[model samples]
Target: MELALIRHGQTDWNLDERVQGRTDIPLNETGREQARTAAELIRADGADWDLILSSPLQRARETAEIIAEATAVPFGGVVDGLIEQNFGEGEGMVVAEFYDRWPNRDFPGGEHDDELGARGVRTLDEIVGAHPSGTRVLAVSHGSLIRGTIARLMRTPYKQVPRLDNTSISLFAHDEDWRVVTIGGVSVAEAIPTTV
Candidate 1:
């Protein structure tokens, strides 16, 4: 089975560097354009997908819709479990603002990194197990969630994982074991290069 994972395009909140966990923010004009650019790239790849899964967040949903339309995949759907990590009281707060507000604070519900990774691992296991072998799936989600999933698959510490750029494409597949064929390649930024 081959799974293609993509992080949603930039939102206004993303550009502002806000902690958008569970905020359900919609895409801005540039974000929409990024999605279109992503669609064009995927179409050019000429690969067929059997399933498409997206996080329930509006930004992710919008990206998935564009992929489904461009790829003509009929099995596009939302999976709430794939939602971004809930930032609790940090939602919509800028990163600096969050640190300032809770200089010594802990995550709400007392959740730690391990707890979050466990949940992400379980969700990914279910997503992979539900589909048959050789099924090609496209999953649209948030950066942290995708990073956590990749960390779990690699059996590595979450902190050691590489950051996935907005609209970055990752390809994972199962041979003798699950493997990440590609990582952190061709992001939304690269789609429209600007000389600055």
Candidate 2:
């Protein structure tokens, strides 16, 4: 299966730099526009996704819905394990504040990196197991989860993880082994690139 993992569009919380973990915040106007632009790029690229999976969070759901409309594919089921890493007491706090509270990046009463990484890897692995090979799938998820999952799948250390942009598409193919086709590929309003 070829999986396209996308981070949700921008939310008010995102603009405000607040930690949004399972907060269900809706996307801002700019975010909606971003999704639409991404959708157009996907269409232009001729990326025909057979499945459109998403996290239950409103941000991810809305972005996935837009992509489904643009790609002309049915929106697939929401997977629980795809949800963002819990921020716990860090929710609504500034990004800097989170670091200040927990220098090691763990939110109080929230999930740790190892567990989050495992969840991300497990969720995609389950999907891959349930589906046949060569299935084109798009999954709308969060930044941290996407990064963690990709890192886990690649077996890379924390320092090697790359930051993902909103609506940025990362492609990975799982035949016998997982191969990263691209990472942090953006969708522009102009002509879409043929390759990811």
Pairs of colliding residues, candidate 2: none
> Weakest 10 consecutive residues, lDDT, candidate 2?
187-196
Off by over 4 Å in 2: 186-196
**TM-score for each prediction?**
0.84, 0.89
- For candidate 2, write residues 1-196 as lDDT tens digits: 8998889999999898888988889999989999999899888988668889999999999999998887788898799989999978888899888878887786678887788889988888888987777788999999989777766776665435666778998877787777666667733212123222
In model 1, state the lDDT of residue 104: 47
Number of the top-ranking candidate, with TM-score as the measure: 2
Model 2 C-alpha lDDT versus the unseen true structure: 0.82
Q: Any idea what lDDT model 1 has?
A: 0.76
- Clash statistics: count for each candidate: 0, 0
